[model samples]
Target: MIRLAVVGVGKMGLSHLSILGAHPQVRIEAVCDTSGYLLDVLGKYTGVTGYSDYEKMLERADLDAVVIATPTRAHATMVRAALERGLHVFCEKPLTLRSEDSEALARLAEERGLHCQVGYHNRFVAAFSEVKRLLELGAIGEVTHALAEAYGPVVLRPKGGTWRSRSAEGGGCLYDYAAHPLDLLAWYLGEPRAVGGTVMGRIFSADTEDEVYSTLFYPGGASAQLSVNWSDESFRKMTTRITLTGTAGRIVVDRQECQVYLRDTAVPPEGYHHGWNVRYTTELTPPVWFYLRGEEYSAEWAYFVDAVAGEPADGAAAGVNSFASAAVTDRVIEMLVADAAVPCGVAAASGTGASGAGVSGAAGAGPGSRGARKRAFWSLGKLRGE
Candidate 1:
């Protein structure tokens, strides 16, 4: 069994605890959180030890891996501490508030030979996973454009908020919501060369954005648009979808299903016709030992457990959403945040050509350029008033 410690016990954290507690190959070693009341309750019922101090927990617990579901601000420190203890880590999305930190953490984990995955669980979702498979199979030949969108009812009214509503904490709509589609975009396409026309709109929240809109330009002339709004009441829950247009056909996939349309000249994959076809998620999703909000939840944990156990079975094929991949997404988020701060108007006024200011400079830098990695520092410094 992979002895694991679960940190944080909030909404997403509690969900992870419940799912992982039922995992057949996992033994819950301990849980750590700041809330003693929540910890005491979990201990009384679940029979797992609990701790209020994270450092204390790390010092005493027998752990092979740690699943960290803390706030974005807490991730870098917590993950680094756990890695120093030589424990594998599964952290939540937007690995850290900054791409540089996420990249550094990725390198640290690699040096220690530990598995460090991020909770971009959309990668485990059947429809989204199918999209990746199809793209790999060239079912949609040479993707030309993609539109990734997400909508939910998160911040609809003005009120005092938790860490989620604060830009310095949870990163608001752009990080909390937009990161999902952004990660998927990076997974399907490579790192974006540049970001443009990024907009962060504040509908209800005073501190951070409620809606996010941006465009990502890729190296091969392909492009993607991101549209995310957390203030939409029409969605009963968060709904993320992606539309891909390629040379041969187009694919539209959401949590529920994948829709495909192919031109007459394109050759269809097996079981797919040379026209419109639909595949439900149930058919594509492999069965899980336990079910929760969705199979993807258990599926991701299962993948992590297998990886930690050093058993490369079917799980290895899907590929874990490693910290490395999350870094790519994080850098893209930084570019978006920097782009939203100052768009083409500011860039044009500053004689920086009209793409944007800092982001345009970042875009102009080669993907591997030092400027690309260091350009966002100025915008972040400006955001922090440093």
Candidate 2:
């Protein structure tokens, strides 16, 4: 069995512990948190050592790996410390709020040959996995264009108040929630070639944007439009959908049921397109829940366990949630910030027509501290060029 230590006893961290408990091959060795009350409460059921200091837990526990679920700003330092000590890491999303730090951690993990998994869990949802397969089988002949949107409450608190509201803490909905759609799109299509968007801080008092709608043009003339909002209600009201248009047929996966549809035709085709036609032709069916639901967390954990054990078998293919992908998301967030000030495709005063500013900083450093602050350093030449 692989021994594990969970850092941070928040809801997410607790969820990880509970999910892993069901896996027979895993054992929870320790639970660490700064809250003494929380640590004591969780320690009772976990039956593991508890520590308010993560460093103390790491030094004392002879464990196989650690789950870093702390605040976004602390990801880089904590993840690096674990990998340097030869422990595999499973961290939550945005990997790091900044690109540079994420790059550094990726390099460090590669150098040490450690397994690092980020939190973009939607990749594991069976609905998406099936969508990827159907696309591979040419069910949706070459995807012409796609659009993804995730609108809900702003998960971040204000910098002075909570973690979700501050740009410095990576609190915006773009990084926290929309990350699923971004990663999903990138997975279905290829890497995004160009990304530009507009962010509006409409309702929220926090510094970062509460709503963002973006357009990403992919290679091969394919493009994707993304709309994400914290102010709207989407979870229970409208399910997430991915519409893929192709020459042969079009596939739609309503977070409810993964379904397929073809332009109405009298003659039926053969081979792979068999069972799915009747419903699309007849009437709308109930949404399909593709994943095992319970397996969402276990699948990821199992992959991490097997990968760390070195008995590898398509483990990486299961969806790594690497730092690089998080960097891409970071770039999109930066583009939104830059685009907010200046319209996309418009040439600035510098005579050169650069679209937006490239906010560079250490990965996982958070937005306000890096991207927001970096924009302040650029002069007219730099700004116009940016």
Candidate 3:
């Protein structure tokens, strides 16, 4: 069994521990966290050893791999340390707040030939995975454009002044929530050429952003738009949807319920049924739909474990999530942070009227496009089961 060490006793870290501890292929060797009190409590409950310092834990634990769910700012340093020690790593999302740091880690992993999995959990969901498969088979027919939006009540920090309130910790609504939708978009299309957006912190006294609206442009006229906000008091919604109008057909995905509709042929014919039918083509049978099943996080963590076990990577069609997805996300955050002065509900001051034109260039180019090939290559590898 692979001996797994969990560094960070936060909510996510605990989730990782629970998930990993139960995996047949893994043994929860040790747990580390800055909070000695929390770790001690968890240790007593689980009968697992604990450490206050991650590095100290790493030094003493007989571990084959480490899962890093520390605060966002610490991701780079912690992941690098684990990888440098030749330990496979399963790190939480936004590998680093800065694109350069994330890129560096990606390079380091390549040089070390160590497995590194970044958390982009949605792609592992059965419904989202099915969408990935359909996109790979050209079910969406060369996606030309898409949109993703997520909205919910503002995030109030459980602690008043934690790292999550700082920009350095990647603590922004977009950074926290948009990553999923952005990753999904990249997976469906490709990376944007140039991305610009507005990020604002209007709803609360929080030090970071609460809202963002971004657009991404890809080659061959494909484009995508993403809007996210924590300022809304509306019903909580986490949607990774896409409306693809290809040369042949169209496909739409509602990630929350794993529902999809495809109109490949005609719209269910224009005629009515016999017998019990009262009307003719009144409903038109709608479009052919498919439903997906399974928990997203379970599938994602399971994949990470498999990758750590030497399974080939196949995340390309899914748009090299992990660090690559984080890169684009970072760019969006960059735009948001750069234009933070703009009110949460207002567009950038310029208001050129490109409809969130601030965030979209062309695909396969620009800083936002940083690791597309790596992402795509791994995706192809996955498709070939390499």
The numbered model that scores best in TM-score is 1
The clash number for model 2 is 16
Task: Provide the TM-score for each candidate, comma-separated.
Answer: 0.89, 0.78, 0.75
Against the reference, the lDDT scores of all candidates come to 0.87, 0.67, 0.64
Give stretches of model 2 more than 4 Å off.
153-160, 237-239, 263-294, 314-319, 343-386
Q: How much does each candidate deviate from the true structure in C-alpha RMSD?
A: 6.0, 8.6, 10.0
In candidate 1, list every pair of residues with a backbone clash: none
Per-residue CA lDDT of candidate 1, range 40-69, in tens? Answer: 899899889999999999999989989899
lDDT string, candidate 3, 247-280, tens digits:
5455555554333344444222223121111221
**Residue 383 displacement in candidate 1 (angstroms):** 13
Error of 3 at 332 (Å): 4.9
* Reference-based lDDT, residue 103, model 1: 86
Give stretches of model 1 more than 4 Å off: 315-317, 343-386
Provide backbone clash counts, one per model. 0, 16, 10
Q: How many clashes does the backbone of model 1 have? A: 0
